[model samples]
Target: MNLKNYPRPFYAINQFCQPQCTELAGRSFYFDMDGGYDYELKVLTGDTCEWNIAGEEPKKAVYECLKGDDTTYMFDFDIVGAEPRQNFFFCIDLEQSLVTLVRCYIGRNPKFPLLVASEYDFGAIRVEGQPLPKKRHCLTGEMMGTTVEWHWNITMFTQHNYYSPAYYRITWPQYSSAEGSISPNFEVLAASDEISQYVKIKDKMYLYCLTEEMMERELGDSSPFRSNNMIFLQNYDRMYHVGRTFGSIMMDGKVVPCRTMFGSFGNPVRLEYNWLTAENPFTV
Candidate 1:
């Protein structure tokens, strides 16, 4: 099936649990911010669906009677807490079919500091050839103090596709370790036309950085050098072999293998890769 057409922001049908049984399964969502404010919850569900928000006194019912095969629930609310505080939580009941949850945070003013948030899906059933969705979460600490109004949007969905390889380019500024100085790394700068393609299946997504060399190779230059700089990556799930390199090239005409470093300063060279397609094998 065309998994691309399925709901992507909420949950995909084949990538996560299938809605085939009657169970009170749900996910926990959390949002944290630095400013003090108030908020509200908005929920919509398919026919015969039920749900509730945590910490809401009187146990207010977000949705009780959903009517339809596909239902969408949206929660928009303010956050009221002291500086460096968190606020938000909810649970959903899916009897059949998949449920999509779209949660957004609207700050009361422009003073909301880095809004941190996350969501947990409770009692999710395991399926084959599919990966469990990544917990929806974000944490942007005090580095981004509350000064400007902002909105945080999180979406979850489920879907499935064949295993494919992808590529990525990580660029950093150039630095002089001996001199203890920093400068822009011209060699690692991306071209204006560089674009990235994301292959997403369910909660897993592989990001591919399309470089000029890769484009040239794909267009028909059967050169060994082109194959040496290409790599593939798998970015979702807990897989160690998420990426593979085509080796490395020398900055002054020598050849060397690429090494992974935690910091990105002084690195004059960047990496590239070849993403697998339905018609092409990763090794090619």
Candidate 2:
């Protein structure tokens, strides 16, 4: 695909993503979240899943999963016909028997403008006759004030700047003088709309999440990202990431709740000035 001038704002990116993943199709797992909510999920082939919270009737919807290095998988799906639109994302580690769940919701209340707000929690995978892992993923600052260049697709390139403990910035790509127009895109994010969430699972393995709340508030239709949660688990040592994204996106011809997975590899980005360590530039 000639991905020139691909437009969807950065918020609803899907230009050069990996093919849909099916590694988790036909798999079933029960999750016991520490937050007291339990769920049973059955992933079917062909973009559909049947899942339910404990004691609730099963609901089916389209789903997507992306497999990453060393038995890590990312999957997401929405609750069809749900009020306010609730989408579920999972970062599962089969080797560790651990799981992380992110509940991304479309809170489009005019008063709140909650386009895509999420609540995160950690849990254990339930397997018959197997004990859950005693250890769980924890919050960390290992990637604080660092930068990595991620290639989302063939021609889509971007940078992730861990600008602050609470914020991360994305640098969009401009033309590369050396490669000319045939090359991909890469660069730093703007100073605004850097709010972020981070979690560490092991040495050099972490999770990063950011939403388009501020971007929609600032740029509306022009922002590269839209009302979605871009959540990914990155292994810095391996320079690879698997992510689950969910929100309303323009499909066919209309906007609908969507879930998807993507995988990519990246390397440490060399920067002249570190956003994490540099003086506050956005402060007025």
Candidate 3:
């Protein structure tokens, strides 16, 4: 497969298994993030694809049908199911040159849930194509080993089994959905417990600090991040999340502070004790 033809990094490209989607439906692909999927489609079809997950925005892939001298083709897209090997069905009518959604579903993958389990509050931001805020300044990070440019991207609140009635109804009906959203305002710098540390990306330097008070409120029993009766601490100190939330960009000897929060995001997940939560969701 041509790597440039795809929008983002992908795992495998197998023969299209869905029985109905026949016109040029050559492969089934898997990607960890929506941004990757969107990037892939945009490069292939030259149209912005929109697949809506968790009611956020339609960020799914789109296909454009083509008619040639002797063949009809549908824009190639991935077929996702409850598992990698399973074949979920979708159809494309050859005569009409229009693809029909016969049957489709997205399977569960553990990578995201595992990577994001503890740091659930770390929102994913897509920075590549977006413009920064007016007063916001860019910073680079230098840990004395490597100097890296840190850019602000899109911010997304990660969660598992986020509500999508139609999506869950077909993919994995047995699993229950769990939701929570408590993020730390500031991050902690644990580089040798020094009161403050300065990291530079080229000429830009960032000063860091820490905070206290991890909420003691009880999270629902069904919280996906909770494991072994302890809630996954959504610490903002994770290097990536901290770089966006707390680090102050230094320019011309003046410190430019970042925001405690960015964009108009939904309200933080409210934590309540004895929440009578449901059982954990089983991955498809």
TM-scores vs. true structure, each candidate: 0.21, 0.79, 0.16
lDDT of 2 by residue, 1-284 (tens): 66766664642234334566777877899988898988888887768888888889988878877665658877777777878888788888888888898887777558445478888899999888988777888767777867888776555566667866677766554642213322222123234445678887777788888775665555444433456777887877778777777665544555665565666768777865644455544444
Off by over 4 Å in 1: 1-196, 207-241, 251-284
lDDT, candidate 1, 138-191, per-residue tens? 211211111111011112211112222232222221221211111122222232
Stretches of candidate 2 off by over 4 Å are 1-16, 112-114, 176-190, 221-225, 248-261, 274-276, 279-284
C-alpha RMSD (angstroms) for model 3: 23.5
State the lDDT of candidate 3 residue by residue for 74-131, as single tens digits.
Answer: 2323333323221111122233222212121112225321111111111122334544
Query: lDDT per prediction?
Result: 0.24, 0.70, 0.22
Please provide the root mean square deviation of candidate 1 (C-alpha atoms, Å). Answer: 20.5
* Model 1, residue 272: C-alpha shift (Å): 24
What local lDDT score does residue 13 receive in model 2, on the 0 to 100 scale?
Answer: 36
Best-performing candidate as measured by lDDT:
2
Candidate ordering by TM-score (highest first): 2, 1, 3
Ordering by lDDT: 2, 1, 3
By lDDT, the better pick of 2 and 3 is: 2
